[model samples]
Target: MLVRINPASCPSDGHLAALTGERAFCSEFKYRRGMEIFGEGEDAEYVYQITSGAVRTCKMLPDGRRHINSFHLPGDMFGFENGATHRFNAEAIIETTVRITRRRNVLDAMTSREKGAMNLIGFVTQNLQHAENRMLLLGRKTSLEKVAAFLLEMDQRQDHPDMMILPMNRRDIGDYLGLTLETVSRALSILRDQNLLRLGGATQRRVELLDRDELARLDA
Candidate 1:
């Protein structure tokens, strides 16, 4: 099943206000590409929802390597922490705008409304499922398999299904998949030469899956 986030389709303030009996305490903030939104171990005072553009949540290793946990596209909600501190550092993958609300306010609102609590539970459950699937992908997939899987995921997540325009860079992809940047590039080249996909666009971020069945077989 293909699933994508669309900010335009997100519930308006009215719907949320109806459920919680309180208006959402939201404020819009903009960040330039590569700007840090929040740092690891920082206080988790707020929950964030993407209004436009993309964000990457990552952690820095002791060896100074970066490990990307996930990408937050438009309409995606993130920054839910189990404790007071953030576990990952979040940054803008491109010029982005996000709506942020105080975590305490959300919890207080949910406490009064059963529907709101259930919605929050469902949202967190979906994120956990995605994390589990990624764990499996990273642990056992081959280099080519990983790249194919990543492309398929991007296709499913993007606003456009026919043409995939990735927002993140090769380094980000490598970090997410536990591969080197060179490995990721080589895999894409191999796939293109095999006629499984066509890569276009100035930065080669746009792709069209030529033989999706073959790509899926490779991913499997």
Candidate 2:
């Protein structure tokens, strides 16, 4: 979903480049770990591109459940809405920096710059594909399978190939995968025991896929 907002209506933050009448300039801002970038139902005034670190976008249910929609990594873009307000909350999963531009400016560029427009389409396509895959993971996969697939995903997204340094904690992973934190922890322990992965780091955020092929088979 995409939201379009007038640049003049927003606050005069130095982080907003469109305030200076630039066509596509963006200003960088820093977000501390666990800081909320935007909240559900808030005005969708900016489109953000992550320069470093990671972010999680999630929806809160009336019963206080959270369903994480996606995790945005460095070089990833997020915070789009189909209406005037956002439907989910976005927060930094780690200390992060992002460059933000007005949604209006980005929308204007979509029509004027061919390359920019193509990039938007490509990014949207990727999100759609990811959503489909996630649906399958949530609806059909078992607890073990879901955890395996998630580890593989983080491994790939972290771009370390076979090893991963997870930025989010067990509760976040549980919420994203529709499992209890105990379940998530148990699955990782089981995988470790099976020689599928090796956990390092004091907090166990560092994980090395010991047998990628076996993990892939387990995920399948």
Candidate 3:
């Protein structure tokens, strides 16, 4: 889906203009659930910001096995790899809207201001930290611990005080956690059995935490 920024809420008029360029060139393109945003090895000409919904980035092995690298939610940015082409495929997990900006414009803006460069560096560093954490999660954490860690991270990111709404499904979670779909479902069942989480409705959108401290301990 096409997304446009309201001029009033933008960080800076000049920056916004530079980012969007001449007219509001914004267009909304809708993607059905599981639609590909961009494929692996495609030219990375544009950087994307999630306007609504969620997107999953994944790499696939020659044998057709998939490993999800991360999920990008509203306001999250992706497709900013420095190389000419993207290394992974990005797909929308639900109906989604994304604001697109040409990479050349962003690079030019960074060249004009040291602050822009700093911001880009900070963004890259944050992504690196998340990658390291995921590496730890997949390489060492137990199945239960991985699920617990995932919930805790989602809670922190979404800042849901009473209940957390998951935007992705079991298969997406499984690919991310390096487990099968059945494993992810079983892990959620185990958490529910332990009274650590309450699943609401058939969609599994509502998730209430019963014990924050216990969840943290499991993360540890």
TM-scores for all candidates: the values are: 0.88, 0.86, 0.86
- Which regions of candidate 2 are displaced past 4 Å? 1-23
User: Which scores greater on TM-score, model 2 or model 3?
Assistant: 3
Q: Which is the better candidate, 1 or 2, if ranked by TM-score?
A: 1
lDDT of 1: 0.83
Superposition error at 111 for model 3 (Å)? 2.5
| Clash pairs, model 1 backbone | none
Q: Each candidate: how many clashes? A: 0, 1, 4
lDDT at position 103, candidate 3: 78
The TM-score, computed over Cα atoms with residue i paired to residue i, of candidate 1 is 0.88
**Per-residue lDDT of 42-109 in model 2, one digit per residue for the tens?**
99998887777899999888899988988888767788887999889999999888777778877775
Per-residue lDDT value at 202 in model 3: 87
| Local distance difference test values of all predictions, in order | 0.83, 0.80, 0.79
Tens-digit lDDT string for candidate 1 (148-191): 99988887777537887789989899999999999999999999
Please write out the lDDT profile of model 3 over residues 87-130, one tens digit for every residue: 99999998887666677766776677647666667777888999
Order the candidate numbers by TM-score, best to worst. Answer: 1, 3, 2
Angstrom error at residue 177, model 1: 0.4
Question: Which scores better on lDDT, 1 or 3?
Answer: 1
